[model samples]
Target: MELDEAIEKRRSIRGYTKDPVPKELIKELMEAARKAPSATNRQSWRFLIVQDDDMKNRLQEGITQHFVANAPLIIVCCLDRHAFTRQLIEKRVEELIDANVMSREVANMLYQRKLPQKVEETGIPVSAYLDLGIAVEHIVLKATSLGLGSCWVRMFDQERVSEILSLPLEITPVVLLPVGYPAENPSMRPRISMEEIILGFI
Candidate 1:
């Protein structure tokens, strides 16, 4: 399917069939996510695919939306906090410099910027969240292109989910994506006019 078609057809699928999503298709979605760009090329996104009934039930306890458990698969999208540490940021910058994608002067300038010195900081960096968001959107669009349906779910207990998944301290769950065959065909949601969305073209 064409990219524009997929974008138009995509919806927040709240209902799904019982049929399981194929493993190959799941791999394809992950591949699309793998190619997404990230801040400083840290590539800090991580995904945990859950399909087991027991695991799904456990996850449902934390998620307010029970429909998520009905899907055959749920992708736990996460961000690796360690990726934002000063050390890793420097490493990624150096790699860009070596590849000629970034100049030594720019790398030096980046080092001068203030960054999280420790990975254990209470608040995750906004850039880390943006990186994960891009990767997750890749998965969402790829799922649509592959004749599957998905929903981006964020109304959940983060700490509870982290415990249920046994995620390490460095890994933080950001979003939950439920994927399967659509059981309901929802009409397109309302949108603001293009003029309203685009303030001004400089």
Candidate 2:
């Protein structure tokens, strides 16, 4: 499907059919996420594909929005601090080389050398969470193309989700994505006009 068509057709479907989403289809959606551009190609996002009933319920407990647990699949998007640190280091090194301050070999060495120390210091920044938004959008667009449905949700408790998923240290939950066969046929929500949104340089 054309990108614009996918964007227009995609909707936040809260109601879903009980029909199970094929594992392969879910894999394909995630594959699209894996290809999304990340900051410095750090690819800091990690996903937890949650389908089990009990676990899904547990993770949804702290979420004020009850529809999140109703879907057949919930993709928990997490950001890896270590990965973001590596990305920052690589990006900084590249900027230095591009500015003619460091040779190619020197830049590569510097990226590798400083990564571990940065990881020890700051781990990762909240800005890396933006990468998860990009990845989730890719998955959502792909899902729409394949006649699947999803909703990007944010009304959940972070600490509760961390406990429910048993996420490792330094992996922070960023967003929740519910995917399945949609039951509702919601009309497209109103959007701001391009003229209202875009600012001219003049």
The best candidate by lDDT is 1
Off by over 4 Å in 1: 114-118, 121-123
lDDT tens per residue, model 1, 96-127: 99899999988888989887889876357788
- TM-score for each candidate, following the candidate numbering: 0.94, 0.84
Backbone clash pairs for candidate 2 read none
What tens-digit string does per-residue lDDT give for candidate 2 at 75-128?
898887777565666775677678786699876665565455455565655557
As a TM-score, model 2 comes out at 0.84
Give residue 202's error in model 1 in angstroms.
4.1
Stretch of 10 with least lDDT, candidate 2: 113-122
Candidate 1 lDDT score at position 132: 89
Q: Judged by lDDT against the true structure, how good is candidate 2?
A: 0.82
